[model samples]
Structures are given as C-alpha cells and as structure tokens.
Target: MPPCASPLLLRRRLSTRPPHREHPKLAALLDVLNPPPPSSTPLPHALSSAFPSPSDAFPLRTLPRLLPRLPSPLLSLRFLLWRLTASTPQPSPHALSSLATSLPDLSSSVPLLLSSSPQPLPLQHYALLLNLSTHAGLFPASLAVLRHMRSFGLVPDAACFHHALRAAGSAADVSAVLEIMSGSGASPTVPVIVTAVHKLASAGNFESARRLIDKMPEFGCVPNAVVYTAMLDGMYNFGNLDGAVRLIEEMEGSGLGANCAPNVVTYTCLVKCLFGKGRVAEALGVLDRMAGRGVMPNRVFVQTLLEGVCMEQRVADTYNVVERVVGDRGMSSEQCYNVLLICLWRVGMTAEAEGLAQRMMKKGVQLSPLAGSSMVRELCVRKRSLDAYHWLGMMEENGVLCDSNVYGTLLLGLCEEGHLHEASALGRKVVEREIHIEASCAERLVELLKQYGDEELASHLLGLKQRPGGLSF
Candidate 1:
C-alpha cells in the first residue's frame, strides 16, 4: 500500500476487488507501494500540473490554499460545497472544521486572482461555507471567514453577512463586523446595510441599529422600501414596537430621500408590530391608511395579522380584520380567512365565526377544511338550513370539502327540517357531485321524497350510484 494510505482506505480498495482478481492486482499495486510526499511548488504550478485529467484525488486539505491561483476557482469550490452540504452522510465535523479554518487565507488569495478575470467572481463559495459553518453553530469560524474576505480585499454580499450576524454572540460583535465591512473598502450593498441593521437590532442595540439606518447614505446606498422594511422587521423582533412606529413616522414624514416612504410592505411590518404589542385597533388604522394609499395588504401581511390575533385571543378585532382582508383585492386567500375564522372558533367566539363565515360566503371566498367543517356543522345544528346551504354552496364552488362527509351530514339535517325543496335541490347536487352519505341516510331521503310524491327528488337520490361524483375519502 502507498505510505499515505490509511488502513481504512486499504480496506475500501480491497473491498471493491473480485476474489480472484485481488491476487493479480495486488502484485501490480505493490510495484507502486511507496509514494513520495506532495511537491513544494506554488499553487498555480501545482494545479496546472495536476489538472490534465481532472479526476485525480489530491490532498483535500491544501486545495483551498492553492485555489487562488486558478483563473476561476469556483470549478473546484463547487466540489468543496458538494462535500459540505450533502445530507445523507455528511462530512466529518473535524474535516469541515479544518476546511472552514482555512477560509480566510482562501478569501485573501481570491482577490489576487480577480484582477485577471473579467467575470464577476462567484464569491458565493466563501459565503456559502460561512453560512454552513454558522448554521452548524460554528460562529467564530464564520467570523474568521468574514475577516479573511477583508484580508484578501474581497467583499461578501448581504446573504453571507446575514448568517454571520445571526450567529453573532453579542451586540459588540455585530458592531465590530459592521466596522470591518465599512473599513474594508467594500462598497456596501443595500441588503448588506439592512442586514447590519437587523443584526444590531437582534443584539438589542436599538440605538446603534437606528444610527446604521441614518448612516446608510455613507455606503452610497440610500435606504429604500426594502431597506426600511428590514429595519421595521428588526425593530419589532427586538421588542421595541414603539421604536418601530417612530421609525415609520420618520420615514413617512421626513422621507428616506429615495421613496423610502412606508408602502404596503412598510405598513405590513408596521401592522405586525402594532398587533405584536396588543395594539390591534392601531393595526387596523394602519391598514386603512395603507389601503387609502392604493396599496392593499398582501397575503403574507394578512396572515401575520391572523396569527397575532389568534396568539393573543383578540376576539373582538378578529371579525373586522377578516372582513377587511377578505374584501380586499389580492389579500383574500382561503388560508388567510380560514385562519381568521378558525381563530374566532378557537377563542370560543362561535357567533363571530359564524358571522365571518357568512361574510366570506357573500364574497365567494373559499373556506379551509376546518373552517368549512365547523361553520357547516354549527349552522346545521342551529336549524339554519338556508345559511348552511348558502355557505356550503360557496365552499363547494371553491372546490373544498371534496372528500368530507360533512356535506352528507348537512344534507340530512336539511331533510329533517322539512325543507323539501332545499333538501331536493341538495339531493340533486349530491347526485351530481357523487358525494357519499351513509346508506341509511341516502335511503331515508329517497323514501321520504317518494312518500311526498316528489318523484324527481327521489329519482335524483336513487341515481347517486350512476354518477361519477362519489366523494374520494
């Protein structure tokens, strides 16, 4: 075996051999048993000499150091990332640690190669490794990689710094990183500045975070809608809803000089902040203002509103919020209204949930499975067959409750209430939809219709088996 080959590697090689061929290959392999150490040549020479065939395995440990000499090093960086991010059986912690430890030197050398290549360097390599290290809870190593980028006169993008900031141990470390980024002659992208603000906010240095927003101009990236939105998210997460409001006022009244005024997203984040602090009434006011400006809440924003209302059990405000969002353009997803409706039911506000369900039906909005089931069940129990049919029709139109017995149950309740016309209409629908009910229920409905001399209704009920609309499960 070669001198560098470990016992495990020898076993691996032998395991791939056929029993008969092992003896023959063993003799040939023995001829090249003693291998020399890696050469002392520089990386450019080493790589140029090594890559004629490109598939040869070399010492993985030294590749990062040698990578800078290549015109476009990402070719090899791709291989490195493949090893680091693979899921089924990941690389050893020791190996990953070793690779991350070498990042600074790799980043430092990368800039030297950039002067020759005209393409935008795929610096995502170092950033990706930094992200993985940070995700793996290797914060110090992630920071080391950041410093390495600076040492090499390289600038990592916003996403790279996002991971580092999240992994930061304290507010001070966050400030130190921002300082390094600013001093490194790296032109800060807007996202990078926003990430810095977010990190500082998370670290509870609200004062410093606000200052960073003010200082964004120095980086030649004026705060825009996206940047201000980040600040709003950070401020809220840091538990300073009041500060978030002040920042929004500042952005609106004072202006961010590049249309940084609170748009829908700004109001969206503001709405979250308001509801986060139990200011549900105030959140509604913000929504009105946003809508007045011709920018309505998106699905994500409305969903956030629903979540906060549910979390705090804000029963009184739930209906109004649901009504407004459901009636708006582009905000009324079935998921959003369902959460709002379900929140009402979860907090014991059945009356309010029923009211909202009625409103959703009027608007032709789809109901989620749970919401649809709850409303239909409650309406039927209240002997409100008309309302149940109305809402059920709405839900059916929206293509939900397809595989549920709830429709069958609702039909039975309608029949029992002696609303023969409504019951017959639903019976025809059941036949058309091919929805399943219990055998006895179906037979009872058919027998009742026949006794009442409603031959058409009884025929529809009996024809259920001939249709292809049976419920799926």
Candidate 2:
C-alpha cells in the first residue's frame, strides 16, 4: 500500500479534477431562489455555502438544464457570463430559445451581458446574442451586439455576419454591418459583398451600392459574374431597365475572363426584363448573344422565356422558342415541352393545354413533377378530381414524384365532390408516403372521413398531419 498523502498534497491532487461536481444541494438552493433576486448576485454567499467546495469553480454543465427554470432572464444571463470563460459545453438551442423569449428587450440585455464580466465573452456567445437579436427583428440591437463584439476585439465569422445581414432592413443597416466587418479586419467574401450590394440597391441607394461594388478591389475581392448579376437584378427591380441593359452590355464588352462573362443567369435576367417591357425581339437577340458566347441556357432560362411569351398570348412564338431551344441540343425536347405545358395552363389556353396533355400521356412521355402537378391542378379546377386522382396514379406508376400541394389539392377537391372512396385512397397514399398536407386540408378530410364512419382511416390521416419532419404548406 502507498503511504498516506499529506494534507497539501491531497488538496493539490483533488484540484486536478473538475472544480465542482453536480450537487443536489446547489440545485435545491436554485429551486428555492425562485422569483427572488439575490441581494448579491452570481453565487452570493448564501448560494455558495450550498456547494460542497465553496471556493471551487461554478458547475457549468448544470447551467444549461437550469437556465429555463430560472425565474428571470437576468439571473440566467449572469450564470451564462460565468460559464463563458470555459470553452466546452456551449449553450443548447432550447436554452437559447427560452432565454431569447424571456428577455423583454435584448437591446438592453446585451450591454448588461457585456458589462457583467471583466474577461472577454467567447465569440460563440456573442454570435448567440446576434442570432437572437436578429431573429427577433431587432436589427438595431443586433448591430449593437456586433459593435460590442468589435469593441471586445472579437471578429465574427461568415455565418455570424450572414445572420446580421439577413436581419438588415435597409441600406443604412447594411452599411453599419459592413462597417463593423471592416473595423474587425475581417474581409468580406464575394457572397457577403453581393448580399450587401443587393440590400443597398433594394433600398434605392444605388449610388452607395455602386460605390461598394467599385471598392471591392480595395479589399482584394473581384466582382465575379454572380456579383454583376445581382447588380443587374437590382437595376431591373427598380424599373431602371436601361441601366440594366447598359450594365449587361458593359459585362459583355469587359472581356475580363470567364468569371466576368455573362452566363445563363445573366442572360435570363436580360431576357425576362426585356420581355417584361414587350421587347420580344430584343429578348430573342439577347438569347442569340448568349448562345453565340457558348453559354447554354438552363431549365429556368427556358421556363422564363416560355412564360414571358405565353403571357403575351404569343402561342406560335411560344412553340417557336421551344423548337429553337430544342434544336440547340442543350435541353431535351421532353423537358421543354413539359415547361410549355405549365406555361400553357398558366395563360389559360385550356384547349391547347388539354390537347398537349393528352398527347404526352398517350405517348407515355415522362412527365416532370411540375407538369404532372399542373395537369392534376387543371383537372381539379374543372371539378374533375376523379380524373385528377386517376392522373396521379398514372404519374406515380411512371415514377413521377408529386409534391404535397398537388396531393392536398386533389384530396380537397375529391371531398368537396363527395368522392369518399377516392379521397380515402389518396389519404392512405399520403400516409404510405408519410407526406404532410396542409392542416386545413387534413382537418377537412378527417371530418368528412369520420362523418362517413371511417374512424380508423381518419386517425391515420391525423397521424400523418402530426408526424415529425412532415412538410406542410
């Protein structure tokens, strides 16, 4: 056996372990302190006496569980400051959610959190405050939190900056966030710069936005195609079509490299904007230029062009555009026609839409999910949900995925038409796929099912509605 250790040696050995252990007495003290502010806060002598080792560090692990139980946000915040010194065991999401909800005004609480501790708060905690403040729509308070972080020499990472940017409501708000980023010596990335520019331009602060874009090189950030695309979007959104056109021309003439070249998105915006102004010929020219540059159009580009022409009641022009894109071999003829099907329905060309639908179904052409959904929707609108239900079966057999909205629409239409057996079959499909429908649709269907004495099926539909992770609209 080893010799017994001396008292000082024993103390030193004990100190190597975690400072404090989970203690029932401390928890009891906290429980008894309900709705009572400590005359002296942050482990007052009364509270400290309950700890096994009064001189030991606070038990940080117990704080997260006890946070919600605390009577006031101030007490919880005080405990948080104490634990911020240690890096491990960050606050849990539930704890943060509770704390954020309890605090009446985060703006005031931020300063209190900052001033309570002498040592710098961990960057994570500051990020938590920023997230809470911004998510609450308290943009000014979020800015203040960021300012305090900079004052403490803490630099926020990209994600934290994004949280603040999302909450920014105007040009001034965006500028303030950028100023904080600059002051912290954290260079904004290209995406961050684009978001800032978009925000500024959206508020009609075009000059400020332009200045930011021009100054990108100052921070070693080059404006890529995406950045230029955002600028074009802003100009078009603000009714500055000419400005957008000129910007695209400049982008085309810049000859910087592929990074600066107009891609599919750039051409899409130009086409949509020009089409919006009834310049169909000019829009076609832009598409020509895009093809000439060896930039291929994607599905969205084709969809936008089809929708634009369809909106103008240019049916022949619509088919011509589709044929032209199909000939380019960039997109399949089936996908192009699927998009045209959606466009035809949108423009209320019902006869043409029905004829095209019949041809596609007879040919067993694989229907895109959007096209399948569109066909079901149009049939239901004509009070033909029986037909919609059959259509869904065929689409499913062909392996076309139908989304929740499509199912819900058909289910509701069937119930409204008193087609119980069909609605029941669809509801079972919903449960089999574990899909969620709108709450309103589910409730209505459930009521009709129970009224018709289908108790078991009704409960299953309710289960679908209450299922975890189910997508509802």
Name the candidate that leads on TM-score.
2
* Model 1 per-residue lDDT tens digits across residues 1-473: 11233534644655565423212333222222212345455433343343432223323444444333222333334335433322323435555555545443344323343333444434655666665566555566567767767767777766777777666777787776677766765666776677777777766788887787777788776767777778778878889888888888887775556478777778888878887678877876876777766776776677677667766766666666767776775555566677777666655566778777778777877677877787777767778877888878877777767335666677778777888777878777777776666556667777777777888866666655221123222
Runs of candidate 2 with Cα error greater than 4 angstroms are 1-121, 128-138, 255-258, 346-351, 377-384, 428-440, 471-473
lDDT for each residue of candidate 2 in 81-179, tens digit (9 for 90 to 100): 444444445455555555566554456667676666576766777777776776566787778777777777778887778778867998889988988
* Top of the candidates by lDDT: 2
Q: Give the TM-score of candidate 2.
A: 0.74
Pairs of residues clashing in candidate 1: 108-152, 434-469, 434-470
- State residue 125's C-alpha deviation in candidate 2, in Å: 3.6
> Where is model 1 more than 4 Å wrong at Cα?
1-125, 150-159, 314-316, 326-336, 339-365, 368-398, 401-473
Clashes of each: 3, 0
CA lDDT of every candidate: 0.63, 0.74
